[model samples]
Target: MSKDPEDRLTVGEVSRRTGVAISALHYYESLGLIASERTTGNQRRYPRYMLRRISLILVAKRLGISLTEVQHVFDTLPLDKLPTAHDWRRLSRLWHTQLEAKKREIEQLERELMGCIGCGCLSMKSCRLLNVDDELAELGPGPRRLDAAQAA
Candidate 1:
């Protein structure tokens, strides 16, 4: 790691280096997704490696993680310590599990949609192909003429 005193970055420098907007950086800070220190002038300063942290925030946002969830993930890290490679690897393992679960959910929804389309069932209550519920009350009443017998 570079130990040059000049290597420490200001918030503007981090924003320039990461190509992330300064407002987004502030938003990340407000969400507790990232951290910074205030200089004597009350300006925010960040470590040079915060570029990586901001990048991780962007990636997590793209993955559909809520800001609160992102904060929870960051909360697990040491407040004063920059993340090490081992820390990143551990986080990535958890992220992989989350991504896998999301993928399975999408696949399940796709299957359900396909079944509904194939069965020509537009009403949730009567659609055996799409409705996973065992009782009619599972879906609030609207239209119920979607049974296979009705289709026939």
Candidate 2:
């Protein structure tokens, strides 16, 4: 379909253009990661640029960033206007810090895994190193931590 310069996109159209499922678009909207306007018929219509926003969100998620963190990053932008190239460059610069931190974390995990494997210290108490517990303690409370049963 030929799109008019001023025409807004239906959710389905946005999905088709972005290659994201319509339900996911709705979820993104609900999460305030994207936005839309309601038509007279109560149908959701989005600005054309939301396609790019969705693409950015997908990329950020793939990088293991949470939606909340992505929303915080988006908060740096002017909500009423589409982002300019300078805005994208500034945002990309912020991402480098995150990328570096992830790289370091991965490197540490690699060393820990290698040490554990080499020493045959898969069990917690008998291990000479404390890599697994240390990382879990840093993470606080999460599924990454050993459950009580597993800890025993």
lDDT of 1 by residue, 10-75 (tens): 877888888889899888888876777766888877767777777777777788876776687888
Poorest 10 consecutive residues by lDDT, candidate 1: 139-148
TM-score of 2: 0.76
Error of 2 at 31 (Å): 1.1
lDDT of 2: 0.75
In candidate 1, residue 35 scores what lDDT?
Answer: 74
Model 2: residues >4 Å from true position, as ranges? Answer: 1-5, 123-152
Mind giving the per-residue lDDT tens digits that candidate 2 earns over 1-152?
Answer: 11444667888899988889999898988878788887788988788877778888887888777888888999887654566788778867777788899899889878766767857645544343554455555656554436755887
Looking at candidate 2, the ten consecutive residues that score lowest on lDDT are 123-132
Candidate 1 wrong stretches, greater than 4 Å: 1-5, 118-120, 128-152
